[model samples]
Target chain A: MMTLAHTKYIVLAALIFCLTPIFSQAEGLIADQKFKADNEIFVTFSGAVDRAVAENIANYTVFEEPDPDIQLELESATLSEDSTRVSLRFKEPLNTAMTHVVSIRGLAGIDKTTFTVSKSYLGYLFGILISALLINNFVFTKYLGLCVFFGTSKKKETAKGMGVVFTLVMVVSALMSWFFYNFILIPYDLNFLQIVVFIGLVSLTVQAVDTVLRKVNPILFNSFGVFLVLVIANCVIIAVPLILANNNYNVFETFMLALGAGGGFLLALYLMSSVSERMQLAKIPPTFKGLPIAFIVAGQFAMAFLGFSGLQIF
Target chain B: MANDKSSMQLITRGILSENPIFKLALSMCPAVGISTTVMNGIMLGIAVLFVQVFSSVTISLFKNLIHPRIRIPTYTLTIATWVTVIDLVLAAYMPEAYAKMGIFVKLIVAFAIITMRLEMFACKESVNDSFWDGLGMGLGFMVGMVVIGFVRELLGSGMILGYDVLGFKPLLFFILPSAGFFVVGLMMAFFNWIEVYYKRSKGLK
Candidate 1:
């Protein structure tokens, strides 16, 4: 046998070599914590429901209460069986203590089921995007941003111009909101001041844009004259920040939401313009000249979008 | 020359004769927005009322003081300052309502109602005349919002002031932006229809 000192040295070396993997494992733990902090809890229906039924359930916020801190990621329903199996995934980790009941209201063959949460960040992100774009759309569901929509939709040329302007404005506003919310508002514990801050920013941005446009290109400025001014207080500017805060999206996901909202705004404006142009040639009744006919057309369009509510592409 | 109306008559015209969204079709932005619920409509109406009355009074009072070249900017700044104050107050004490009202509160600065009233009436009238014009126009706007809100909340959500009223199932479509368009359109048509019926009955050729 070797001397005791020699054996001790060998034992120490062995311990170091064995403990290397454990020390390296600390990095993984950090990643897990980061993931847990960022990840949202989403639940996907696994079986026994059709895709349409599941989608309707997702859009139904009637029974589901609103939670400012918790973001609900309504995923598209996937059907595995003969229209029997349905599943949903949450955007964040589900609270094991709280049970989520998916109520299948008025579906003949569908059964009401409860879903368990699984830890998947990818699933949650996808579900959040779907929910944002379709199920609980800011523009469509809430009627939050109609001023821009109507103002832009009056003319096709103006609508395209407004679309470009809106996208640019949304991106800039979102970045400002993210920084303000994370750094200033949250740190100072002045969350109540969000509305004031966001509104001030929007007003300033609009005034700045107006000044620059008027100075640089009088022709373009005149073309956009009234609309440019009108867009300053447009709901999209203020609402996006509130939504980002409510949903608690990270930088990347926040960008996606901003993009989706901008796109949705453009979509509504474009659709309205096209419909209004068509109505111009059609003989609308005298009483429904300007706004009355527009409302009826909008109602029909809303009904059409309801079909997309059931799509679970994500 | 005989058709020229007095200041009071002109002010009344702004209320009913030249109603912005309904009759004159001037300011569609605020009318279409904030009409989703009674609370939102009322809050917006109050804000608009305050801004319109004050802006009209101030602009009328200082109409000659403002340089013609920069009058628009001066008026905008004045309106913007008041809007900022209102925004802060709502955010502080009425957080929930503020959240619900969203950007429309800020949009008051750009709302053609205040600016239009300033340009059309206040800039050309006495302070007293401008005040009445603002009040009448503001009330008209409030009426429009309330009417739209009543129809939308009643049909779309089947509830009023968060209380169940009609017992009819909520049509989710009505609460959406598309439904706003529909409701406003129908209301406008309905108003026109009534106007036509009354005109015909009174034989006002």
Candidate 2:
């Protein structure tokens, strides 16, 4: 445990070392930015500019900061209907729950002037942990990682094995995706390639895990078997990291999220498998015998999980 | 080549015979995630339909170029590219509905159904056949989502597509995830019951 903690910090330091230069120039002088509930973030400048200039200002936001917590990424900018405001649309919707602080203080908007808007919303760390595990379980709530959960869920042993494997794989993959995304993708200006890169990273990691397990412990390797290959497409494996990177979790918070999500997946899978295994005895209709029945069972499990919605520890 | 009847058959098959979610159980993730509301289900269905049709046709168009050994990766890469582009384009261009679908739209990349179609039908089949199959399967998925979404929305919230027809919450559990499972299960059973009745009425079984 001590060694693990040490290595994490070591890695974090190395990552920050690589990322420092990327943030050197863009000290985010908040200027001429306005937020809209719809995906557009419109920046009104005092004067009008051509499309090319508007595009450049929007593109600059892409590499401005490497904060993983920043929810929105500027996909492109276009002139609004009035042709006065440069409407900046993001890759993802900005989280309305939090206030956005645009740091581009010195950077010029269409107005070619500097202005700032800041709102502080405190994110209690513990709140995130509880939320990830119970309220927003990747499996039960979000329905991610359902393929493997259903495919391997028929039998208790396979379900248990996949659960454990998934948990371990999710934690490691989350960290790896976070590291590469923050250090490499942001600095190198390949932010748009995130989905492809993250999926690739997950598949590669699964392959690596297979090879290591085969050499280290043959017992575990055979037990994991084809499910390892299946993990590549499991929504939770890629989605967790995607969620983490999008939320811009710090190392510790990301780790907690991984642990929470993994635990949630395991819990949901285990509960479903155990109950379904027993449910085989119940009399049922012919068409609903297999997959349809499983869906219903899953809905029941989801209701049980909904009970956790009020668990606001933070 | 087969007649026009075959194409109609292909399209209808997706709606019932080999329905992706209910019968085959290929991609249940989206079924459960977006089915909480009828609008969400419809929106996601349209998105999947667009992605599925394009992916199916693209794979068939480039079937020869993609090496058999690396086909899975190639197919995935293709799907990923389309999904990313669509996700961004929708978010930028259509802000309101885009906000509703959010990341669930991008999650289309991981859908086992799209990838399954590429491997099972798109690669071996001709362009026309693959196109029809993609349409059928995509339609099947969309219908399945709408059914589940409609059931959940009506009972869970006592509303359909944001309108409160029920005037009060029905079961509340019906809309929840657990209820989603039961609702899907019942629908599957209901469909199955229809199949049996149809066959019996025709003196087939």
Candidate 3:
């Protein structure tokens, strides 16, 4: 017969596993609506915190509307048994359409971040897509891909082609490299070999693509030509794995980043090329005829994108 | 006697005629990023100078051993190894300088000029020729960095090498990327005009 203690441990482990997904879906201690119950205030955190952290009492603060002008009375502050939910019962139940803020500080998840949405993985990935694509665009804001940004941006058609190639190559290669990094290099304590490995991976991938395309899509490959070959040395191609590793982005986020970065790169490239094409007609000085003029234009673009810095989407 | 004269020409070429930044337009990425401060520019330039010289000489030494098909990858690996060494040594011995130029040092591996030199001059020439060429290119790169850095630093913060040049700073925009572009543009124009005027004076095309 199975021991009673053994059965209890198994049950607890299963419960934790099931609750983990739902709990981990929160960004932070989001003020959630208390299931149609009157006067009860519920604040749901994303993941299970150390119960000890919740017990600290000082880490939780509740403020009633008006932005720091008033403070709400907490009648009973109860941490859920699983430490995933915190109930901050107001002195009186919320009856009117009122606004309040629940400030949580210094609370870490059981083993991860409070912002990782573990259950609605798709939605989370979408946010990352938008974030990387627009908010922190690789070229405009982050300043990666400067070489290709200027190199192929002279003409609109070439820029578009380069953008498309960059997106496809970066997206596919980033996934493979990310998997290799997290699974192998990281475990073996050989992360110091990142530059060598990352460059090697990219070169190998572009080569594989070349051979595969030659075999399967000879016509398309021939049409595209040497563009794919040039990607091996593009700074951003190598920078992808480095950035992903530095941020320790989850798999979904990595995928989103690759897509978003590539998309942003394409968008920036297209925009830059059009702007420069117009600039060609402007009577620029002979000295500033080429790259110098382009740099100035790039600076203007950087300033325009800086406006996106104040966004609070994350 | 002819070899000495040719080596002299090689070193001078980078400083003026074949200047990497103003003329050839190589390694523009780091040129803009590090030129924000004069000290940063000089430090990064010196680091590049070292790597460019060593890598060029090494590539020249092993030119025969490297296969044509795999030369690009071989050159990259060589540059990358030297860069890593420079990066670590800087971090250990010159923490203060490394603190600022640390990221820039690693970035040297990807510098187009270093590899361009390897392909254009190093593999094609003897080790002795490669050394002078590397020095010229390295000096040219350093000069470009320092000049851009000087203008940016002096104008942006009213400082040069950490010494304040102006009473109160003006044209603060020079420090910004927008201003960086303009400075580089104006400088390019200035350099080009000088080159044109010099060539015309000498009655050469």
| Best candidate, DockQ | 2
- What residue runs in model 2 are displaced by over 4 Å at the alpha carbon? A1-127, A285-287, B1-5, B156-173, B200-205
How many pairs collide in each candidate, listed in order? Answer: 32, 23, 3
Model 3 Cα lDDT, one tens digit per residue, A52-134: 66655466565544455565565766788888786656676553223345555666742322221121445556767877777
Error of 2 at A99 (Å): 11
lDDT of 2 at B131: 85
- Score residue A14 of candidate 1 by CA lDDT: 84
Global lDDT scores for all candidate models: 0.66, 0.76, 0.75
Candidate 2 chain A — worst ten consecutive residues by lDDT sum? A113-122
DockQ of 2: 0.44
Q: Which window of 10 residues has the lowest lDDT sum in candidate 1 chain B?
A: B1-10
lDDT of 2 by residue, A1-314 (tens): 99999999999898778655533432233225545644666666555545555565443443223343643567777776654576667777654333344422233443443333222112344566678888998887887888788788887887888888888888888889889988999899998788888887787788789999999999979988667888877878778777877777777678888888888888888888897889789887677787777877787677778888756442
Give the clashing pairs for model 3: A23-A46, A26-A46, A39-A93
Local lDDT at B147 for model 2: 84
Residue A43 of model 2 has an lDDT of: 66
Best by lDDT: 2
Q: Of the candidates numbered 1 and 2, which has the greater lDDT value?
A: 2
